[model samples]
Target: MIEKALQVFPKSYVYRNEELILEPRNNVYFRLVDVETEIDFKCKMFAWVSRPIAKSLNKYWAPRVLKSFNTLMDTNFTKSDMYLIYDRLGNDVNRKLTIRFIESGYDMELLKR
Candidate 1:
């Protein structure tokens, strides 16, 4: 169970008193955290897509998703701070949505699963 948990989670245990610490220190755990977070974000997107809702879906999801992400990553992101920009140069753009993390500044990839 520890192997399975450590496989998906960045830190197996975090200790605190004098200072905060994460276990399994040799794994370069931050990258593991990032991978888990990206997968989670994609899963949420998939779940939201599969949900049977006829209402304005984007309207319902933006705040809810952003709030969850903020709490997970310890970031102060407001709905107003989020931006969706279209940079495709082709006129045949049929709504291709891609998240380029650091360049785009949309750090949903840092969210904890």
Candidate 2:
């Protein structure tokens, strides 16, 4: 799964970084990529990664690190709930829904341009 997600981008750019810059792109699909095909492979990779991570509940879990999300309500939640919340936000595995959901607790409608 990890290997698949990494494959979405160029292999030369893979590495551990001490710092990162995260941009909040509300509409991650059409807005970020000029063509929808770019995300088709990514969506599959996301789905693959989400499955196993969704099952793990140990402290410092993979989902927490990968998603880096904080809920609006400060309540204990499971990884399954996280996946469900994201699924409710967007029907697919694009990270846009998760980003928007993390930004606004309410379900945000994705605009099609």
Candidate 3:
């Protein structure tokens, strides 16, 4: 599973801290929080697509695509501050979507916190 996940999420890394670790990405560290509930898990994902891709999608496909997918799962999406965010409960499909979004001449910005 780790190998498969790496294929989709090469930017993600695993590190250990003194119980709590700060993720280095600027948008990520402030944007995501892990929560565990009795029956649900919550996580967040972000995609930094190209400027043109982001602008084009902002005009049409983006909102519809997000809303359509949101209807199928416990997911909420937002595009703001030059990033697209998917906050969901259970499942990691957001990572797959992030990869697909990045495939179209888009790249993730690895920012220092």
**Cα RMSD for candidates in order:** 14.0, 11.6, 14.1
Q: lDDT of each structure?
A: 0.32, 0.36, 0.31
- Worst-scoring 10-residue span by lDDT in model 1: 83-92
Model 1 stretches with alpha carbons more than 4 Å out: 1-57, 84-113
Instruction: Give the poorly placed runs of model 2, Cα more than 4 Å off.
Output: 1-36, 63-65, 68-81, 85-113
Question: Which regions of candidate 3 deviate over 4 angstroms?
Answer: 1-58, 81-113
Residues 1-113 of candidate 2 have per-residue lDDT tens digits of 22333333222122233111121121111122221453443343233333433443344444443453222133344565546643543345456654454445334333211
> Clashing residue pairs in candidate 3, if any?
none
lDDT of 1 by residue, 1-113 (tens): 22343333345442332111212332211222323454443333222321211122366554544454344434555643332211121111322222333234545443222
Q: Give the local distance difference test score of model 1.
A: 0.32
Per-candidate TM equals 0.27, 0.29, 0.25
Clashing residue pairs in candidate 2 are none
Q: Which candidate leads in TM-score?
A: 2
lDDT of predicted model 2: 0.36
Candidate 3 structure quality by residue, lDDT tens digits, 1-113? 22222233324343442111112231121122342331111123233222222353545545543443333223443444234332211134455544444343333232212
lDDT, model 1, position 105 = 52
